[model samples]
Target: MSREPNHRLAALMAEAGASNKGLAKRIREGAARHGAHVGTTHVSVQRWLDGGGIQSQTASFVAEALSAKLRRRITPADIGFASAPPPPAALGASYAASLPDSLNLLDELAQHSLDDGQPSEILLPDGEVDSAVLSWLVSRPDGLPVDAPASRRVGMRDVAAIRTAGQMFMRLDFLYGGGHGHKALRHYFRQEVLPLLNGSYSAKVGNALFGAAAEISQLLGWTAYDTGNHALANRYLLSTLRLTKVVDSRMMGARILSNMSHQANYLGQVSRATRLARASAEGGRGHATPRAMSLFAAHEARALSSAQDYRGAARAMNEAEKFLEQADTAQDPDWLSYMDEAELVGEFCHCFRDLKRGPESVRFAERAVALTDPQYARTLGFCRMVLAQSQLLNGELEAAVTTAGLAVEGGDALQSARFQRYVADFQREVSVHAENSAVQHLNEQIRAAMAQLDDE
Candidate 1:
């Protein structure tokens, strides 16, 4: 069967005199303004022009780029993608009130993501975050029990296996980066986990299964975020949040929202990031462990730092530290174990670096470096880059070059696009000192390291 040609898109491209390559270039450049890096190629543009659909996030980027060039309000619909639904706002659905709807929505989302393949770009819209948080807060816990068909039965052993697999994948992501194990997680969910959801189980077992699924989903979401698939990450996080509500797991839900906040902050949506972080804290009001609170506060601090509100950032950081002091590992959830003082100090390093407090940034970065595990390649590299950046800004050229070398050494071993972006930013910052021999040599080393990683 042949599909219809996108006459509207072809006509618009003709009117704008936009060659496929030209359009792709514009879209890629435009996407950066929204804090997204799109690998838009001429082939992508050709597909769009041939009546093939693009991801909603990419479609929005396309419309915006074309609208700017053509001086018209071009939309997804205008370009023959009106029929394609937008990326899901799944987190906003009230799990208790709409159990069946939420489950069906998640099922649809999983199928849609598989069908669309990996997204080439993502647009982090503020409205989506606000709506998700608001809906989560107002919703009640699910009262209705799951009624799986009286057929094949699921047991505690099955749930335990899922949880164990999730932990294994989480460890892989921590050591090797999210791109290392995200596909395996997606496959496990689709092949192994989905069947259990459809299998028969008592209400007690069903709750346990859903809770385990939520944790796995959250990891899937985190891995996607680490790999730079922000839109996919958001969808998975939303599903996790909804599942958390279904299981009445407030602490876990707060953790999910905190992850969402981290992504929002990365995308430069500072205001939305702050809102989500605060909302997460609020959601975890009674149940959040001290470690969890520390994590939330640190995220809030990052958002404040991004907005250049140094005092607010400082207060949030203090709160995080206070909470960390009170944290008891045994009382905290397993997920909260990683949110230790080292991580908090890394957040401080990030905050100070963003605020251009060179000495403070270096101090915290050094502390974080000492405390961070060697197995956490991506985190260590990020902290080193921040330290190098602080050294550069503090006018310690030799130390900056040396620290940058260390960063690149670790970077070469990781497969994280976020790490690459931060390194790129560091590269651009150091390029200003191109007159120095040490700076030039360090630049070459970094480029070579990145090239080796790419080739591998």
Candidate 2:
């Protein structure tokens, strides 16, 4: 409401060198991909310049179009459109007692969460996590009903499409961060996947369909955690955990528990984190492959380290390393593509970092950096930052400064709030080196990078 003349939007247009007609056409084209019809013209653009209002969705379109041209992420607020909505207070909280119960809930939750673009500072209550986990622990896996629905004919092709989209969204989250494609992922799930769940299918086809839906739901939880909506993340993960029984996927349930442990640690629930991680390992032992089990053990190592259980942490890491060595990637599920040496080592490095074993942490961090895919900017930046911290602990000031600078560079390219948090936390830790000119210069770089992020 403050920018009555909409000068900010005009300036972005000029900066992107987009004419009124060109920008209007761009918005329409982007909308069309999402099956939205837009009739905007240069005339509408002119009205926006003269202080006329734009729709929230159109505002989002404008911000996205300009971000593409400028090659940086920006919100509607950056161009004086109304700020994106706050995250939902709660989502997908119910632990469905049956497959049919979960289907309707998942459908409703995916649609509800499509509008949750920003994280709320206030976290949701985490007590329900224990309740959901207990429910899942006792729930029996059920086969799809023998009698198929006659609503619409759902087939393997429809399941394939949902599976493909789930993979794509997972990759996008890995590359850019959860804040990047979360809403669009939810939008895709709601639009493309939910309808098929209601369609008619044979028991075999229905099993596959539920599996595909569980994958997307699991990803929705993962992204929600990355975006700092802890409570929302808990609900999504819980819902996905309930869905696992439908598909009879103990491995998937184990993965959900691992994620819950990860979030619990981040939220400072040390004991809960350790419990959840241990549960993942216990429940997934026979059901999960070496790669999946390795990841679960690594998570337990992390939670143990957080609680200052040195011997316990080391034992868990040993198991993880052993399992990692035995991993066979060729037979991995599509969702388990991230369960590799790089991810395993990254977790190991963080665990050591938590245990204050600086040299050991640095060793694992270097391996993580060396093995990490360059496209995974968020994880790479986080590992680099941890390496820098390890260097600082070892009294290697110059190496720490250089590594921290590299982390800052990697972080600036990402759209992840979580990665930004890492950079910020490292910045505070490096304050002890304030007297060194190199450290001060790195500090300046971080400040400028933060400004770039904050300005948007």
Candidate 3:
């Protein structure tokens, strides 16, 4: 006979600060968020508490919802796999009260992807609970014993080295594609960086190293996202957040939240995206520089646009512009330097395109294309596609065809599925003017490009 699953639902519930009723309510709410329907009832929740297993599909839903609420990834094993280790001594009331937010945040960060087939928004709950918990966790002092051996003391020099290496990796990643640089960076981090974190460092040195490691881990997540590996990206992101807590860098934590907001917007979770972006803006208030603030505002505007809140979006954009105006180059974080006026305007153009404001999109896109570096070929290609779309909408078929040709030329160097979608969109628009030789030729070329992509 098969062994009965070790059901730790009661323990898990306690750790989450959830009464049976609260658990039921969260289940219903989570279901609704994911476009499912599950009644909130004592009996339904009781089954879970009583150690009765749910249907596989329902289990997945419950797991996802609970994970979201807890802010960490909660596997069936976490609740109780068939055979599992005894609960930890720390798995008590205090731990229970904070577990939900941690699990939820982890889950939210862990599921992002940049794949073409993926939706363009990520849904996140309001930041109220997450901000509070993360703030407290990150602020705690490193409690390494004073009498520890010499091997434990990580020096400032070591921390500096790690930071320098991480900065180098970040620059390379931005210049090359993520796929080109990710593997070596990850390998170095795992082999060289993590061990130092485990060693005996002074409190100050340890915290700095931890912060550096957390930032690098976040870069790994970004690389995974860029490569279309959603699951891996999610894992890396979670690890990054966890490390940030150990390091206590509030600014870094807020930056990660902003990144999550960007991923959510890309995934079509507009409301969730807005919530995350707003949380990022609010959380980073004192800790982040003006450049970081501008980027956060831009993310919120992008989400608001996707949610069809044109006025709200426009207001956010305006605020972002104001923040950008105040940004001092020397004072800004290195990461924020890439987000210049052109990048901000490019985001606006994309937002306008999402909102179907073709003329506005075209105007903004033209400026963005003019300002962006040719080395940023993917971004340039996307701007061209947006311009072509705007021209098509304005009945300038010839102009649209010409712009799309330029986009295609740029696309030839990109390996992104999202970029291919732009090509498809351009082809669809050109199909209306198929009687024109230029349109016909462009369509044939697009089809041929798509065929080549398939072979690759």
Candidate 4:
């Protein structure tokens, strides 16, 4: 006889705020109290969720924990250790069917947009496609070939179209965050872009398209990561890496790895972040342009800083600087065009700030702000926050408040929760100087802005 599925048990664990480890611990502890010998562990809990049945004695302990924690009676029979039903065929199908159609639609849209020199509209239905299917597609191994002759030639027209789409998606992400516009982008990529990777194109055109698709996938991952959907982000990032490999673009792959490192750092996986960043820097060494190398080194430094390895971070920063000094905009790819001197300075300043090198941080931050575009509000906000913190460290309360105010203004147009957290950090720093008029005013303004955000 087949085993029962543990769907209800999975739901109960989630509702009880029990991680696999926590669930196993609870089971073991509860069983011990009743003088029952059970050898359950986190792995056992995971196995159970994956449809493995436990011994009847151990199941009794799990049931007891669930009953106590959920404040409802739950028995071993209710846990359901039976195998799950097979997933829908459409959900499990390869990209050959779904991806090709999606790409054809996108190609049509692209042609129309290029002809009119206007933004094309794409409205994906909410119900027809399973969100998880896209996730699965991105996670699957990259073995498909591009079948289209026209798509294989990524000309100036294609590049321009990709740039336009990327810019539009970036704007949407900045305005409404990842939740609002990411699905459409993801659907487009899964349906339209992935198929073209294998179509009949020259190596040159195919590689360029691969690079563009990789970038879009990274953006999709960023959106998902920003909104705290870690599993989805990982899938997107993995797909991006796979696409980058098709193009043999180490720099693009490194960038995706750096993003993964950043996500790992934020999630408190410091060791994983460090390892990922190190691997990225190493992988990017020979194939990457100076700008790409510098970017990768900077990412490594950031990860080291997060792990509180000040000396290691400083060394990495120094290497990044050397590469940055060697970088020429003329020789760099269009994707790396945005990594100008100002951005490099900003990255170094951030590293210094993390290491508590206040004076050095302030100097670089001031330069970064001066060189950066005022309209690039997010970067400006970050620079301002760094400057404020540096000034605050140097006991310059008035200067700190002034800088923080600029950060607040710059963050006004940004809807990122991470950016808001930076604002909150600035507010907390200034709140200690409550008696200062400028600080008081800054606090009031921040509060007003937060309130406005809440109302919105």
lDDT of 4 by residue, 156-199 (tens): 46745776787788767755666557668866666666655555
On the 0 to 100 scale, the lDDT of residue 182 in model 2 is: 82
For model 4, the run of ten residues with the poorest summed lDDT = 113-122
- Ranking of candidates on TM-score, top first: 1, 2, 3, 4
Candidate 2 lDDT by residue in tens digits, 402-425: 998998886534356566556656
Model 3: lowest-lDDT 10 consecutive positions? 87-96
1 versus 2: better TM-score goes to: 1
Q: Per-residue lDDT for 103-191 in model 3, tens only?
A: 33333333322221122122223453354435544456333333256555578898888888877877665544455467677677766
Models, CA RMSD each: 5.9, 9.0, 13.1, 13.4
Instruction: Tell me the spans in candidate 4 whose CA falls farther than 4 Å from its real position.
Output: 1-160, 171-184, 198-202, 227-231, 411-413, 434-437, 454-456
State in Å the error of residue 230, model 2.
1.7
Residue pairs with clashing backbones, model 2: none
Candidate structures ordered by lDDT, highest first: 2, 1, 4, 3
User: How does each model score on lDDT?
Assistant: 0.77, 0.78, 0.64, 0.65
